[model samples]
Target: MAETVKKATRESFGEALCELAEQNKDIVVFDADLAAATKTSIFQKANPDRFFDCGIAEGNMMGVAAGMAAAGKIPVAASFAMFATGRAFEQIRNSIAYPKLNVKIAGSHAGISTGEDGATHQCIEDIAIMRAIPNMVVLNPADHWEMKAATKAAIEYNGPVYIRLGRLAIDSFNDPETYSFELGKGITLHEGNDVTVIASGLVVNEALKAVKVLEAEGISARLINIHTIKPIDRDIVIKAAQETGRIITVEEHNVVGGLADAVCEVVTAECPVKVTRIGVQDEFGYSGPAWELLDAFKLTQPHIAQVIRDVVNEK
Candidate 1:
């Protein structure tokens, strides 16, 4: 395999926004004074007139985006995941989602990978919060290429969207030329029969690494990348449950109300199977290096592989 270049998803999102804006004149971007960190500066630089800096108020920025969307403009409001989802949730729920406006909420610096920003900045519950809103499409792209594709899709889709982006640069797993982005569809990266590993965002690469380890140990672990969390691909989850009998969910978010909850909801209704969730165990993160936090929270490749082995053994 060729060496994959590493890039942050936020960088790809910013670049994608610039490219999309060139094609769509109605696309406008709003930032809560974190343009540089969120990489929204790229769009601002490319299209100064279309970009709005709403200062440090995330709630106001969301409201502004909603207003823009209501007026027939495709507005993208972006900020840190914590503020984007937690601080301005009401605005998103009422001002955007309730009316089903065509606004894209891009939450950058998501998950424990925000490194050194601590629990206050890291957002483990954004997925749950955004997924709960009606008429909202939640997306968590795995890497640079996926982020670019997902961003373009979000702009084209005529509904409210919450896209989670990470600050940490990660290795590209999907080939940009061949990979296609479909809303609410799960992409199977590696096929297997012994067990299925469903992962999203930064943890998808870790899940891929774990699958390789399991493969060497004679465990056929299927890897599924779920970029679209809301309206999650139910058919894929059910098929995995029936074919594998055991599933492991890996994510960088809290185990509660996130990927684990989403997966269990599908399996319980259709096919009941033992599902092992690997993620932050309902605890707040502390200040630390991103990789260190991932290891401490038991979200690294080794931990995921061990969990898969344990789940398979239990089955």
Candidate 2:
């Protein structure tokens, strides 16, 4: 069998920006002095005139992006997730999301997988922060194809968008030829009745592996991939909760106000199932190897599989 391709979503975001630039002449890019790291330099190289490096000022870059959006251009402001969502919360809320401007915020190096940079740079809270603002659409694409399609979708949507890009390069779980990307729709990767596993972002592939492992062990576990966090797929979540009677959310984010919270909001209102969350426990990350951190945080396949077993056994 051929080896599966592994690529970081940040690389995909940069490539997506470059590919989507030709679709609209008004598409422009703004960076915060970390183009090479964020991979926005790809767009910069492709469209130098349209790409603007706003130095290390993420907040100022957001303000400029808002201004550019007001001037009838589609601006994609790129930076590390922490700086993009944390340092520029006011600008993002007041300038872009509040007015519902056509600005796409690409927050690269998101979550605990941003190794060695530690907690200060890793941004697991960005989803919660961005989703709280009115008119801000939150997206956390799982793989290269999803990020590519999401980039196009964000550019096409007529409002502010915040997309989390992962630093770790992961194996592609979705097939590019058949995969479809829809805004606010979660994909059911596997269907079962014993329990449901809802996942997003960098940990999705791990969740899929866990589900497969459960299937082999005679446990029928459902798997749902929630790429869009803000406008979560309530229908799928409700159906999973109603049919499976249990839901376990997994993400490379904090258990609070992230994928788990979103799923809980849907199921709690609609189906009221027993929901278990597997993610960071509202704690700061430490410097370590990226993959090692995933294992330490219990975000890998083995831990996820065990969690699924435990959730399935819950009576």
Candidate 3:
């Protein structure tokens, strides 16, 4: 395991994809005309023959990737998160998810990080869209370590997988010496009785930071980093809800149909608890820096802490 921490999820994905391509000859890459921007250029430089630049046609690229996967090649397709999930959804559903093709849809510049590109490019509905599709594996890693491990796991897992990558870099959370990745399993960063914060992607790092702030104020906060959004770690969430009377779900996506919604669906049916969601409200994002966008949507650390405090105080 590497000890270095990353600043952005897309960079983490780029580094991990290059490493995977070196180890697996069948691991091929396809970029929809944004290799340099998406950082897949590293893999393209290392394995020229195994890399394909499919221009800006994400839909066509998806169909081609499905074809390649059907031919026994492990195709990892890259594109803007918006186009990958928004424009190419039908192909992803019928061609990839339906047949359960061995394709890894590694989308970069997800969420509000495609800053300045505005709402037209930001993928706020990606998680909800991807997770709703049957037979598709959805992953939203918290940091660099989880990204690398999840990348490897997605490559080995036998099915169509959608791994969301953010443009904003996040600090490494797990201790390299001990932490190991597990698919569909949740990791509890802190054990608390007052509240539990279930988060994914860069927001997980933020929630962990908020937990420290909460601890200083005498609030014991439990942090659950949900790396897999599709096969969500419902057991861990239900257990947390059972123990912690209040729960706060956080993410870099819309509050509806994403991690928060998923957790609520599980907890409300299995073990009802006080739940508050911290994320982009149901709306499109505008052009701005990533942090500004997060702040605008109330997905910041302080906002999460405030939500936790409010939810805990309620009833």
Estimated TM-score for each candidate: 0.98, 0.98, 0.97
What is candidate 1's local distance difference test score? 0.94
lDDT of each: 0.94, 0.91, 0.88
Clashing pairs in 1: none
Candidate 2 residue-wise lDDT at 185 = 95
Residues 162-278, model 3: lDDT tens digits? 999888776787776788788899999988998888999878888988889989998889999999998998889889988886788888889999998999899889999877888
Q: Is candidate 1 or candidate 3 better by TM-score?
A: 1
Q: Whole-model lDDT for model 2 versus the true structure?
A: 0.91
lDDT of 3: 0.88
Worst 10 residues of 1 by lDDT: 1-10
State the lDDT of candidate 1 residue by residue for 41-90, as single tens digits: 99999999999999999999999998888899999999999999999999
Where does candidate 1 stray beyond 4 Å? 1-3
Total colliding residue pairs, candidate 1: 0
Clashing pairs in 3: 7-169, 7-170, 8-169
Evaluate model 2: give its TM-score. 0.98
